[model samples]
Target chain A: MTAKIALSDVHKSFGTKAVLRGVNLQVETGQSLVVIGGSGSGKSVMLKSILGLLTPDSGSIKIDGRETVGLARRGRADIDHQVGMLFQNGALFDSLPVWKNVAFRAIQNDGMNESDARDLAVDALKRVELGPELLDLSPAALSGGMHKRVGLARAIASKPEIIFFDEPTTGLDPIMTDVINHLIRNCVQELGSTTVTITHDMTSVRAIADKTALLYKGEIIWQGTTDELEGSDDPFLNQFINGLAHGPIEVEGQKLDSAASPIEAV
Target chain B: MTFLATIGTFFLAFFEQSGRLSVFVGQTLAAMLRPPIYFRIIGQQIIRIGYFSLPVVALTSFFTGGALAIQIYYGGNQFNSEAIVSSIVALGITRELGPVLGGLMVAGRVSAAIAAEIGTMRVTEQIDALTTLSTNPHKYLVAPRVIAATICMPVLALVADIIGIFGGFVVGTQSFGFNAAIYVQRTINFLSVDDVTSGLIKAAVFGFIIAIMGCYNGYYSKGGAQGVGRATTNAVVSASILILAANYLMTALLFSA
Candidate 1:
């Protein structure tokens, strides 16, 4: 069967700084593929390109065997209609109340009226363990964890065919990170939606990913199942997964003078 | 070599910006013509851009009208002081000061406001969120603001014209010892429809400039808080300058015959 999403030889750059140079990735329907990458590793850019928020310099991005690159506005919009995104910052519309934010796509695209959308929002909020009383409050009034929950609710509220989560557990504490990770896993499993989550958090990856890809230097250098991730001895993969400063992956502006170090057991 | 490179870079950047702005304008115009016009949003924006700007425009027009009267009374020949002051005040306010000053004031307020709000939205990724929601930002954000400002500015200018003339009337009758009836009559006589219409037209154009500059700057704003601050400043500055420049062009064109 054709992959739910496929990106082939995708190249993107901003001025002289190249990001996503010839990246190749694919996610099968109902599979949770976590893209592991460090900060500024083109994770967000790649996600945006997939979401049609950013155009790649050159490449093919296909959804269920259809070419998405350079699609017309209406055509691209049709693709976007089936996709939901959870941004790293939550990116909630502060001008809107929580319920409005949660119900935005439903109201705007699905043509749901206020009362119906509100009911839908309340239901979605419940799925994320949030109370209906918080619905009337602005996003600014919510704490960071609440913001992420509401964002997740908004993302899943539409029951989109595909979902992209950008660093879903980045800023949360360990417990909240665990909570978000579990919530993401549960939600995606429940929907049976194709998902590509980009993050460097090992715990999050292990928690949610069916398969994982390592993105480094604008390319997917390695990909395998979660069990294989732990067992693999690839220098770059081991270095990153173990958070080793001394490895094939250089830190700061300088490379370590030593050879690739042994992967330390966590 | 460095100096030449610097000059080349400046010209290139300027042309690049010009091209981007032209494209933005085209998109805004096209979006304005598209379906799902969001009449409700347009209405809200009208209240925000026009109704909310009334006080500043009124106050500026009033003071400008009084100042023009005083300068005319003192600067020109004192013979027929009442007629000259009243006639000149009415002409200046309706033909020039009313629209120009009012446009500048509103530009400062509205343009800065649009830039900051939209810039924040841009940085916070709310704009991207809108796209995922399948709502065109141009239609939802840009068109309503541009439409409201363009529609409301002329009305605002008309109000300014009336208040500005009143400012002159108060000064002329109360302070300058001129008869109230005579001053009113002189102003009514001197102010032709064309004069008022020209100012109103300028106001409309200025309104478009304010909203477009704000929207464009904000829509493309990058970085974070500092970038938003810069966008706000650029919006006000560009809108104010464009209003003045457009005012001059309109004045010359309107009166050339």
Candidate 2:
């Protein structure tokens, strides 16, 4: 079967700093691919490039085999309609009430009536185990965990075919992270949507990922199933998954030899 | 050689800035002319940018009118003081002061508010969310604001003109002891429809400047809270400067004869 999303040799740069350098990725339909990387490893940049929030300097980004690179906002409308994104910090419109924020895509894009949109929002919230009482409340009233839940609700509300989550469990408590991770898995399964989530949280990666990819120095260095991810002795993968201080991973412009002892490398 | 390089760099930067602004203007105009205009958003902005601004614009025009009367009476001889005060006050307020002052005040208030709101939205990635939701930020956010401010400013300036003329009338009749009827007549005789129309035109342009500057600065805001703050300040400063510059250009063009 054709991949639902395919990125090949994607390169993006900001001035002298190259964020995404020759990133190659693929996600089959109904598969959940989680990209694991350190902060500023160009994970977010890659995600943005896929979403058409940023255009790549070179290479092709295809959605359902359609070339999407260099497409203008109007050109990407059909693609955007089938995509949902949950930002790192929820990114809910603080000006809007909770229901409005959840129903924003339905009402604004789909031209659904306000009443029906509210009903859809209620249903989406329920899927995330949220009650109707939070509908009229502002996003400012929600706790951090509640914010992630609401963000997830908004992302899955329209039941788009493709969903992207950016650091979905960052800043949340352990319990909340697990809750969010499980919810993301359940939502993706329910919709049978292709998902590409970017995060460094191991617990989240194990809980949510069907296949995991390791990104380092702006490139995808490793790709495997979660079990493979855990068992693989690849220096980069081993160093990152075990939270090691050394083992061929560059730190502050210094590269640690994989054969060297962790203490000596440090 | 160093001085020449500095001058060359300045000119290049100036041209680059101008080119970017020209592109922005083109995009805004395209967004405005497109379908899905969001009339409800435009209406809300009209109330916010125009109706809410009445008090400030009116008060400024009133005090300005009164001050003009006092100055003209003191400067002129007794015989022509009443006519001179009434006529000059009416002309100045309607043709120049009313629209310019009201525009500047609205720029400070409305421009700053737009910048802060949009800047916060930018830093939070809500704009990106809007795109993901299949909505164009330019169409939904920027264009409605630009349309509303452009439509409301002329009306605001008209109100300012009337209030300002009334202020001059009160000062002329009460303080200068001139006949109220004659003061009103002289003011009416001196003020033509063209004078008011020109100021309204200036007001409309200034309104466009205010909204566009606010939207532009806020749209590109980055970093975080400090970035939002900087965007807000730049919006007000740029809008205010453009208002003054546009006013001069319009005045000279309109009254060149």
lDDT of 1 by residue, B1-257 (tens): 99999999999999999999999999999999988788988999999999999999999999988888788887765575545888989889989899889999999999999999999999999999899889999999999999999999999999999999899888877787889988888778877899899999999999999999999999999999999999999999999999989988888888996
Models 1 onward score TM values of 0.97, 0.96
Please provide, for model 2 over B175-218, each residue's C-alpha lDDT reduced to its tens digit, 9 standing for 90 to 100. Answer: 87989988888988888999999999999999999999999989
Q: Say which candidate scores most in TM-score.
A: 1
In candidate 1 chain A, what residue range of length 10 has the lowest lDDT sum?
A257-266
Each model's RMSD to truth, in Å? 2.6, 2.0
lDDT of 1 by residue, A1-266 (tens): 99999999999999999989999998999999999977777898999998888999999999989998898667887788888889888999987899999999988777799999999999999988899999899999999999999999999998989999989988899999999998998898888899999998999999999999998889999999999999999999998999877767756545653453434311
Candidate 2 lDDT, A38-132, residue by residue in tens: 77789999999999999899999999999999898899899999999999999999989999999998888779998998899999999899999
The alpha-carbon deviation from the true structure for residue B74 of candidate 1, after best TM-score superposition, in angstroms, is: 0.9
Q: For model 2, name the residue pairs that clash.
A: none
Write down the lDDT that model 1 would get: 0.91
For model 2, the stretches where C-alpha displacement exceeds 4 angstroms are A252-266, B1-9, B78-80
Q: How accurate locally is residue A38 in candidate 2, as Cα lDDT from 0 to 100? A: 78
